[model samples]
Target: MLTRLTPTPPARAPVLPTMGLMLVLPITASGGSLGELKGMSLEELADLQVSIVSKRPERLADSAAAVYVLTEEDIRRSGYTSIPALLRLVPGFSVARMDSAEWAITARGFNGRFANKLLVMIDGRSVYTPLFSGVFWESFDTLLEDIERIEVIRGPGASSWGANAVNGVVNVITKHAGRTEGTLVSGYAGDRERGLAGRQGGAIGETGYLRLYAKHEDRLPQKGLADGSDKDDLSGDRVGFRGDWDLTPADNLSLWGDLFSVDSHDPWIDGSDLMLQWEHARDSGAGDTLRISHDRFEMETATSTDDASIREDLDTFEVEYRHRFAPVRRHDLNLGLGYRWYRSLIEGSEVRAADPAERSFELFSAFVQDEIALVPDRWYLTLGTKLEHNDFTGFEIQPSLRARWNPRPDSTLWAAISRAARTPSRGEYDLVGVSTVVAASPDTQWMPLIARFTGEDRMNSERLIAYELGYRWRPAPVLGIDLALFHNDYDQLRTLEYSDLRLELDPSPRWILSVTPDNLLKGRTYGLDLVVDWRPGASWRLQAWYSLMGMDLNPVSGSTDPEGVALAGRYPRQQAGLRVGVDPRHDLELDLYLRFVDQLPDFDVDAYGELDARLAWRLDPRLTLALVGRNLLSPSHLEYGVETLGSTPHEIAREILLRVEFTY
Candidate 1:
């Protein structure tokens, strides 16, 4: 249900290489790159290969993880451009847009703009920021056309990815240079948003391919908090290049880089990243890979009156090596070693300052994973462990054990138990935050109080132990069902512990409340996800999904953080969605999506349901036009509040857009 569309291949003819080759080499062809399962029967869809589970291509029915794949067909038919908006397709993802440039996204529970438990990657490059151990969703500008697929693992992936993968891992894989050939141009027009994109690709020598692309977009401000307009106008531009070369029959090399500058607010946001990788695969199912990358970004943050207007410049350098091979008769093993260094420059306004404005840190990690084919084609067991060392936390260990059993050829059951961690951010260890004034209540706010968040050098990592079980079954040739259940226990969560109340005469005559960050919060969350796919006829496809989540958080004996008690209600308890796609004629397509979200009583957000419609007509083999509408159910509604800064709840407005795309 996550991917609503797939190419209607004639007579179920799928293009694929050998299993061994597909697992060892990064093939960019159309076979496994962007294809979905809409057109394929339930039986064929069950065997679709996905790699997010153990970093190797494995059949969907055999994987011991909760996974979702949004393919190229889904992106083109949905008429959604932003990555965060498209993530709504997944029932497990709790996505909320706070403004034109800010979003709160998470899996299961603990949803916030600064949600630190989800790890995100772009073509294997990490996008998680170390400043706060979260992602700035607005900074991602990858064009939807360039993406091959969005693979989402709804549970912990720390054994494959590193820290912050406690909740889930989202990897946005892009189309390799070979698949994006020729020239492409696209233009979009709407009342609230407009954008243009162009790309060109060509052959390099006899065995290499290269592509370059540029994109620009701008949006008018959204509806104001109290029935007026908020001053968050957004505009940005991005340029990127990708090149892949087949050095030899057994070796390949790739180099890619991008530069983006955004003028959303006064300070502007800018970033650049470059990476190089080499891979070699042998006939014996052995492969080796070496990768190196560098990234730089600059941004300014002024979220609240008490929060300082800080300008930050940061740089990251990383080097990694990975090898995969068969160690014994029935054991497949993967080994990896990695090192990363982060350096940053932080400058704050006169009201605030970072403890160490200029600082650098290093991280070292190693991991090993083994897959045992216990019953050849019927049962499998995978065990993995990751050991990492950081400056703040001396050492940490993450481990996972997963098992899958195929009771019948058409039914599979899997279970997993994993331990993952979320490391401390620089702000939690060295930054001194000032919360100037906070309202004790909404009515008659008196008493000037200052809340300062003090950082501690000795901070422990937030930890999680998760238990999950899943079942996948195809009752008929046309219908598929997937259900997953999970329970998570969390420890060492951040809590606000006040030292004492005192009078500070210097900055201003006010009562100073020293609130130090502590790990005195504990909680447990449980959830279930259900997805169903049905295709009655070749031209008609229908999908439905539902999600339920519950949270119970408590502060420890010596902690006094009321916000922790209120945090239990930040996310909805129930959500559901339905999607339909129709292609009555060869040249026309129609798609409809309807989604419902439960109310967040604690945050003052009401329940809302919305609809999205898209109609596309193929004028020619190389050109197409479409009309799209978003949030058609209502004029506007509030999805969430930027509660950290106590800003007015943001209202989302409806829009109608026209899109034109052409290829040459």
Candidate 2:
């Protein structure tokens, strides 16, 4: 186990929306009603704190490119029992279950076990692993209620966020202590699932507030648990907490820390892990803010047949400051600086020991952005650039330009061009070793020495240049639609090829694993996203979204299926979802949701459709009854494939779950 903490200082206040006049309407048998008040104003809605593509806080109506926001209300209404489930509603994102303990999630394309292009953060703390430069979604469990909102930026964000933000960025922001200023507890049990969560927050004094939460859950086995399957153990439990405080009127401080652990007894392996993080922020006045954070994660796993155990540890520290200035009434200037430290250590079996050689590095970055209002409320232009220095790549620069035109109060068009990068992961370099195998025929011993190159010692990072355009329209007071299109050109893509090597066994085994990261892949991706929200009547609300994506990798000699490769085109080409709700005046609320994902290639597994539905009835403002169903159309489904020592590959299985929740 590993742990550490750094001192810091913090921050939230809310902007309330004015209430519209309520209408006394007629009711229908379907529990729906007519003549409802309109929705919140764009200003009040955009004030919810968003950092989708840029660090600056701009109204959603004024942003350029594609962005989707999942609010707390959205989470509560969806009735999802987990974070992965909630992500299914995000546009341009691919979320699929690989197994009971694994998930494949990414933006745009290249969705896989090591989806190295996208970046994810929890309350500003990056959760991506330095070992693989990918997120271990299984290890990132948290109380959904603690999350304030999730901002999904569906394009390159490397200009300000640094490397690994190649395709898009997901910023998961949590609620402030002041908002959760009360005691709440929730529990659920159904089918093969059971969970409990509790939270408490309130004003500590006239100027300070704090919030704390803890949660635990036992995951159910896959659909075929009775068959003694080797797919996944799937069973697990986790717990964690978060807190914040307001230090002064001009300066604020906050502290958040959590511990997570999971145990599995199936799939021939058992595993457990823990993670903790702390963050602080300060206001420097003059439209300036500063933030700092420290996070750590540790895990240990063992093979069922072998007593050997693999242990890995990761630690990261980050500091950033943002300054804002007004060049004119409608013009703005912004500058910022950030620093991050990433460290990792791995120990275990010989193969594991040779996997990731322990290492640590530092990153420093600075950025400047200007948002010039071409017109008081109808037009804007923005230009930004980020300069970064890292241990592997001494210096790198990323820049972007964007513009937005709002012809009417409810309609807008936007476009942008940006550059992003994906730095090398731990597995790409440092590891070196050999293995010995005994031949049964002649009792001969064969030892093979395999050396991994420290490519970063003299290598360049992967780069991407992207273009995007989008439109938003609210044709009527009760309806709105948003659409976006994008294109990306890649260079210096990390690629690997096998080297010819000879091996001898009783049967004369000749095949060898050849792998390396080369700047030999070129690819392009394009996509369109549309989301529509309508409130046809006072009691009825409907939401729908559709996505179409295309991805192709440049053909290389001797590679017959380069474009159809697992990571390149494994994401669904089409995805759509719908949500409907009816709230009657009698404190009774009913909501339903549906989702569809197109097929994709995965090793030996065939693509399949995933269906999920939810039903919730609010008993009162503080309590609710909900029935949730995941993959209700089937007991289990195969979404991904895994290769072992033999030629026959196995696929990971899906599961069904039902849960109930209550809050007070």
Maximum-TM-score candidate: 1
lDDT, candidate 2, 543-581, per-residue tens: 888989888777455443333344554678888888877
| Model 1, span 638-658: residue lDDT tens | 998757533455788999988
The residue-level lDDT of candidate 1 at 369 comes to: 93
In model 2, which runs have C-alpha deviations exceeding 4 angstroms? 1-49, 223-228, 234-241, 264-285, 304-309, 327-330, 432-459, 503-514, 555-566, 602-607, 643-661
Clashing pairs in 2: 9-281, 10-252, 10-253, 10-281, 495-518, 496-516
TM-score of each: 0.92, 0.83
lDDT of candidate 1 at residue 203, scale 0 to 100: 75
Off by over 4 Å in 1: 1-41, 302-307, 438-447, 645-648
lDDT of 2: 0.64
Instruction: Please give the RMSD of candidate 1 to the true structure.
Output: 7.2
